[model samples]
Target: MTRMLERAPNLAILYPRALVKRGGGHELPDTRLGLRDVAVERERLTEYHRVCGFGPSDTLPGTYPQVLAFPLAIALMSERAFPFPLPGIVHIGNTITQRRPIAATERLTFEVRTGNLRPHRRGRQFDVVTEARVGDEPVWDSTATYLRRGAGTGAAAPEPGEVLPTTAVWRVPGNVGRRYARASGDRNPIHLHPLTAKLFGFPRAIAHGMWMKARCLAAIEGRLPEAWTAEVRFAKPLLLPSTVDFGVRGRDFSVASGGRPHLTGRAVPAPGNATPHPG
Candidate 1:
């Protein structure tokens, strides 16, 4: 928690350096990242909402703040002292909470810090904690959990989630990952190209878990409050150019293919939350 880095990070530059960062990525230290004066461009925001299947509106999408804070999270995770490499790390789950509605007109401040490494059956895991604020008011926060397979104590893996009946079928093209990467700045190779994915043991390019979460939120967007929390667990990889079953029961939802679960989660109203933001 000592060294604090502040900059308007360029994804194009940072992404390449992250791939070959120093320190073997075995040290778990708390590092702070700050990006002040963050503003939302309406045009870009609209495209993001469209790509994620959410209807465009003046109010920010529930999951968009996390998308805003992701580059800062990447800066922390790619540090030499981090416990795992950026490449091949699996995004197992994500939990996001917003205390109040976030309007499109407000300027934002983003802070990201990474710590809390612990053992998992598959290997090791850690959380990248992020928060977004408008001056002193907290708008959103998230705990994105990732697992580094084969880096832990070999304990029993966690049990699976409930499997619901297929509600809808989706044809996810191979380029969807690349599309999302362009919008979200998550140019992780495993999700973009089949050849790069094979290097990491995936048979084909895979979908971004966050994209799945966003699409899930879009499916039930009108129902969610401006301020709410969503907890999503990524059960398996959604292969690109694939068809998947999407099931949503009230606030609980799931995406699966061939009986294999890909993403599962629930959305709940935040404390004192009532009305949705108006356009």
Candidate 2:
């Protein structure tokens, strides 16, 4: 674990250059990267919310803090202790939770760590955890799970959630993926142009799963609490510039297209001040 390092949110995209991979032993140990004092940037937050379709509110969007802290997370992943390459890892799922609605003006301290490598039917999997707090009081956290495809451990993947009957359809533009790429700074060639997508085995550009999660949250924002946990399992890759159906029943929700599910998720209440918030 490294000592706390402070930085501005805008530089998060390139902070990893300072870290060189020092591959770790088998455990994939838990190392505290550093502490970051995040001063919420309202302008960027509003832009992010706009791109993801969240209606503007004085309170920060539940997922915005995670984005602000991502640079630090990237720096942590760049450490010599990390085992995988920065590219090519597949994000299989994610979980985000918070004690209450975080105001735009609230101060935050971000703590990041990674661990829990395990076997999966497709390959190996691990988690990246990010936590934010006000002084000593915790407010929000996220766990982003990634899968490295290779040598299967024979551990079966988790069962998929039952698909919910859809209530609405969204006609996504062909350029939606590129548009999101600009806003999210995830310019993965696979999510931008068609030619680049085909290089990665995708027939066309695919929408970002995080974008899908944010869009889903925007649709059901009223029902989500400042104190809520959202767990999302990524399914079929969403073909860009296509229409997708959405359905929400209770804590269960899903996004699908061509009668196939793209993602299935559950949103539930979370207690305030919990530590090591699971993703």
Q: Going through the candidates in order, what is the number of backbone clashes in each?
A: 1, 2
For model 2, the stretches where C-alpha displacement exceeds 4 angstroms are 8-29, 273-279
Instruction: Report the poorest 10 consecutive residues by lDDT, candidate 1.
Output: 270-279
Best by lDDT: 1
Candidate-wise lDDT, in order:
0.81, 0.77
TM-score of each: 0.91, 0.87
Model 2, range 162-187, lDDT digits (tens) per residue?
Answer: 67898888887888777776666566
Q: What lDDT is obtained when candidate 1 is compared to the true structure?
A: 0.81
Which pairs clash in model 1? Answer: 123-152
In model 1, state the lDDT of residue 258. Answer: 81
TM-score of 1: 0.91
| Clash number for candidate 1 | 1
lDDT tens readout by residue for model 1, 1-279: 434345557777777888776545565776688888677777778878878998867778878888787888887777677766676578898999988877787777888887777889878888888888777767788999888777568665555466678888988888999988877777888888999989879999999999999999999888887668999899978889899999988889889988888988989998734443342
